[model samples]
Target: MQDQPLDASDFELIEDTLLKYGDDHSVLNASELDGYFTALVSSPVQVDIAEWFPAIWGGQNPDWQSPDEGKQFIELSVRHINALATQLAMHAQAFKPRFEQTEHHAQPLTLAEEWCFGYLRGVAVGNWPELPTPLAAQLQAIAFCAEQDNFEPPADLDVAQHRQQIEAIEAAAHALHDHWVAQR
Candidate 1:
């Protein structure tokens, strides 16, 4: 498990594996999966991949013919999250959150919505205590992301506006991580 950034190939592999063996899990997209991982690692309460994996897989056992490959995936995922968490904790300003795709896609907002939903679910699954004011505000913003479903971008929100919203979400993520780290 190296502290390497997950590249596009890694995302493709993860998405393909989830499609094959996630037992119809909702986190099929890279953004949602990344968000879930980030939340798990940044959570105030401890969470293990062993428990989280089953939950993400919809409580169904992974149907991996090669268990070693599954293990590798889990290890890589944990390492990836650890790297992100470290970056967030050490250099918050330098931290650039990775979304699902690079170029503009048709489902950017929808993907963002799913990512927020996954992130919130991760927080809920943890043994989280009462959140601080900043963290709570961040949660509220993420909740707003979860509620968005319109395919058409709002007239007021152009591409730049949408990107700003995502930047805010990324900032909130870093803020939540900082809050939890300070608690420690």
Candidate 2:
């Protein structure tokens, strides 16, 4: 799909999750909530990866082979993040025309983009192949935030609350993707 997708209730869950955690200091304190948080933060991505993957570069992070190794890792991560941001923007912008639905619709995400991101999440993490670790990790966050659900929205949920929840999740996914782009 070319746009974001979601049922009413899926939106509610996402929003609640975000609203639950958005204000949490931990969410903003760290670049990521998963792997590489501790290890990579202290070292460059390449050095960290090589150190972690001894066969690749032979204990590089601890005793680097070159003075430029750390810089190289930073540059590489930056490139990767930049590229991911462009790709994300392409997909997100691709939704604007389609998701607007009404001339005055505000910050709406389309069903297509949601499906695209969800599908992307599956491909990135679902044992399809060995993909880049950082990208996969970030996609997991997006999936967690924007994930669609099959259940119905609760009976007690008001329409405005549902819409706000959807917007919140969509915003979170977008922000997390932006964080990925910004991290390196």
Candidate 3:
């Protein structure tokens, strides 16, 4: 299969549709959606898409007025996720973690936080073993991103510092992917 990333518009459409149909309690925003997909594909255990879809989508197929569009969304998502898995597997160090860009009034930190939440969910589903010490420390850093909103940023953490944290999280993701692949 071709490994091209999904078009930005297509990604937005799928994310928007899922959000419209998802449970109110759902935390799987657009960035999380990608993270969840990556986790499913990288999972050591085989995951059945049929079962996984509903679970990820708040336990129901999206209530699309146009079934064809819903089907298209699924197809596109599967393809995009497959491409991600391919990249992670074949070129892990080169894998660039995808995150939602800050837009409108949204903060860049929010994107990182949401992406980390989704990524952690994915890692949970994969049932990864306890990571080695250095990797675990990196994972802890990523986990901290999930709590960004709850805690005030340190006075020393300026824009560049925040960006560094995000970059570290991305690097951590690559390391996590490598750890999983090595286990297989």
lDDT of 3 by residue, 3-120 (tens): 6777878778877877777775454467777777766766666567776677666566667789888887778778877788888888666566677665322444434776777777
By summed lDDT, which 10 consecutive residues of candidate 3 come out lowest? Answer: 102-111
User: What's the TM-score of every candidate structure?
Assistant: 0.82, 0.29, 0.81
Ranking by TM-score: 1, 3, 2
lDDT of 1 by residue, 94-179 (tens): 66655544334444442367678778777876757878686788878887987873334555556777778888888888878878
**Candidate with better lDDT, 1 vs 2:** 1
Model 1 Cα shift for residue 134 (angstroms): 3.5
Tens digit per residue, CA lDDT, model 2, 41-147: 21112232333332112223225445565454334334433333344556654221111121113433223233333333323222234336765564554455335
- Candidate 1 weakest ten by summed lDDT: 102-111
lDDT of each: 0.71, 0.35, 0.71
- Decoy 3 TM-score against native: 0.81
